[model samples]
Target: MNSIEVEHLTKKFGDFIAVNDISFQVKEGEIFGFLGANGAGKTTAIKMMSGLLQPTSGTAMVAGYDVITQSKLIKRNIGYMSQRFSLYNDLTVFENMQLFGTIYKIPRRELKDRIMDSLARLDMTKQANLLVNSIPLGWKQKLAFATAILHKPKIVFLDEPTSGVDPIVRREFWNLIYETASTGVTILVTTHYMDEAEYCHRISIMADGVIRLLGTPEELKKQVGVNTINDVFVEYVKH
Candidate 1:
């Protein structure tokens, strides 16, 4: 089954169209890479699908809720993490998780247990009491990802989730993504790192407000007559 279905999804601001009539579907448990250059409308499309923005025209069903009308429901069913680390810097690791879990309305007692479990899974139980700002960049990224999925939302939006982290950490982070998707959570991630894009089950490259290519990594490489996703992006987006 498809966890996200977007058709003719367009976003406009005054005279400019940020995303123009894009369509795609991400299957349940699939890792979908959303690839594009800067100002290529990736963020705009994500905002609309995540219920933070309304599209000017077209339709999207995210986690089975309509993007235009049932946006609230869509918000409740999705989790989001960004490169800038969305968690509170002043809060300790545990506190930040507690805050989000509470916002999701998880009971206090259960939330505590779940937070502990998640921390343990990240091998971050020892760091639970540390202020988020005190942690290293890599750990903070992982913690942010952990906190994003605290409520186990059906879909997770990862925007440049591993951008500044090191190679080893990036591999470890993708492990978390795989583990989550194994249980049927859909992952829609926007990223510039082509190596990370290669890990996606499928990817779409957008340019000038339109998707110029959509396929698996190997398919894209073959179609573009290139050797890597990076080459595909360069060759496809430039045109």
Candidate 2:
């Protein structure tokens, strides 16, 4: 089953197009990577699918809701985390979780259990009272991700997640992403890291606001006569 279906999706700012007519489908429980350089329209496409921005043309269904008419429902059923830290820095970890739980309107009884489960999964229970700003960059990112999915949204949109973290932290972050995807929650992530692209089940590489390539990492490499995803990316994106 497809968790996301986008067809002929486009976004225009007056006469300039940010995302041209693009189409793709992300299967349920799959890690779908949107790979591109800066200003490649990845963010625009993501915003449209996440219901943060209205599209100029075309159609998309996210978490089974139409992007145009049912955006409010779409927002309720999806989680989003960006490259920049999204949690309240002054709020303690537990408090941050509480704020989001309330925002998601999770039941009081269920919220407590969800908070404990998320903190434990990240091994962050011990630091529950610590302010978000007091944590390391990696930990903050992990906590942000944990909180984003605290309400158990059907799909999660991760925009440039793991951008500034070290290799070890990046690996740990990906582990969390894999864990989330394992539970049948669809994941749509945008990244510039080629190695990270390899972690995705499938990837769509955007160039000049258009998806130039779409396939599994190995398939892309084979098609381009390259040995690695990094080479395949360079071959397709740098041309």
Candidate 3:
């Protein structure tokens, strides 16, 4: 079964429609990109799929659990890293990991191994004791991602994860994401960066409140007859 499935999903905020009847599916282990301009409803749609917000209509399923009816199960099956990193500035890296470990109810022995593995993967084992505020933004972002998936969730949601990071760091971050996906973890990532969209196996582009296009990177390029996703996005937005 697909890791994520959305059928005519919609979310409204009073008089404003944040996400209109949009639908898409993400297969297991696939890297699916959600792309749009600012205020294009990417975040809102993700929030609904992640079960952080309820949809006004239609349905979504994540990891074999219904989003609206089985929100708790969905929460347990998914990891989320928001645009802000969401790490406590005062907390040490190890301390922050420990806290999330407890919240996720990971066993003590397993948690220790997982923490060690995560630190090693991030190459931050030596700096585990340092406060989050002392680390560079890129490292902090990586740490946040490690924390989010520490519990080995079935899917991970990254909302504009590479927004403010340097290009080198962003490329490194994408490498980590690629490595994670190799382990059968589905990734539903949202970003406004057109370059990053090309890296995904498939992408859905949102405009106003609905998805205007869904296709592979190559297919999207061919459809718009453009060399880059930026030009494709611009072409759509203009019309």
Candidate 4:
């Protein structure tokens, strides 16, 4: 089943078009990458898909709910982690988890078990009580992801989740994303990292409000006759 289906999706702010007539589908349990440079409209497209922004035209269905007609249902079935760190720095990790759980209206019993499971999976159980401000950037990131998926949503939208993070930490984060996708939670992630783009099952490249290319990383690289996605991107830019 398709976890995400977007057809002729477009977004405009005043006279400027941010997302221009893009169409794609992300299969259930798939890791789909949204790749582009700054101002390439990746975030705008993501916001539309997450039901955080209304499209100027076209349609989308996320996790089986129409983005326009059933946005509340879409929001309930999906988890969203933005580029910015979202957890309250003043709150303890445990407190923050509980807060989100409460907001999502998850039962106390299920929330407790889920939080513990998430911490254990990341080997972060020992730091469960630490304030978010006290944790290192990488650990804080892991915690943010854990919190985002605590409710076991059908799909997750990660908008540059590893931006500004260290290489080792970023690699580990991708591993976590793959592991999540393996468990049947489809992931739609936007990234400026070329290497990370290669890890996705499929990717779409955007530029100046339009998707210029869409294909597997291997296929994209071969089409450009480049050895790396970085090189392919350069070729794309020069073309």
Model number with the top TM-score:
1
Give the clashing residue pairs of candidate 3, or none. none
lDDT per model vs. reference? 0.94, 0.93, 0.93, 0.90
- By TM-score, the candidates rank as 1, 2, 3, 4
- Tens-place lDDT digits, model 2, residues 70-162: 999998999999988889999999999999999999998899899999899889899999999899999999998999999999999999889
lDDT of 3 by residue, 70-165 (tens): 999999999999998798999999999999988999998899899999999899999999999999999999999999999999999999999899
Q: Is candidate 3 or candidate 4 better by lDDT?
A: 3
Q: Write the per-residue lDDT of candidate 4 for residues 1-239, one digit (tens) a residue.
A: 99999999999899999999999999999999988888989888888888889999999989999998888998888998889998999999999999998889999999999898889999999988999999988888878898888888999999889988999999889999999999999999988788898899998888888888888999999887989888878777555
Model 1 earns a TM-score of 0.99
Model 3 residue 78 CA deviation (Å) reads 0.4
Q: In model 3, how large is the Cα lDDT of residue 99?
A: 92
Question: What is the Cα-based TM-score of model 3?
Answer: 0.98
> Per-prediction TM-score, please?
0.99, 0.98, 0.98, 0.97
RMSD of each: 0.6, 0.8, 0.9, 1.0
What is the alpha-carbon lDDT for the whole of candidate 3? Answer: 0.93
Error of 1 at 98 (Å): 0.3
Off by over 4 Å in 2: none
Model 2 TM-score relative to the real fold:
0.98
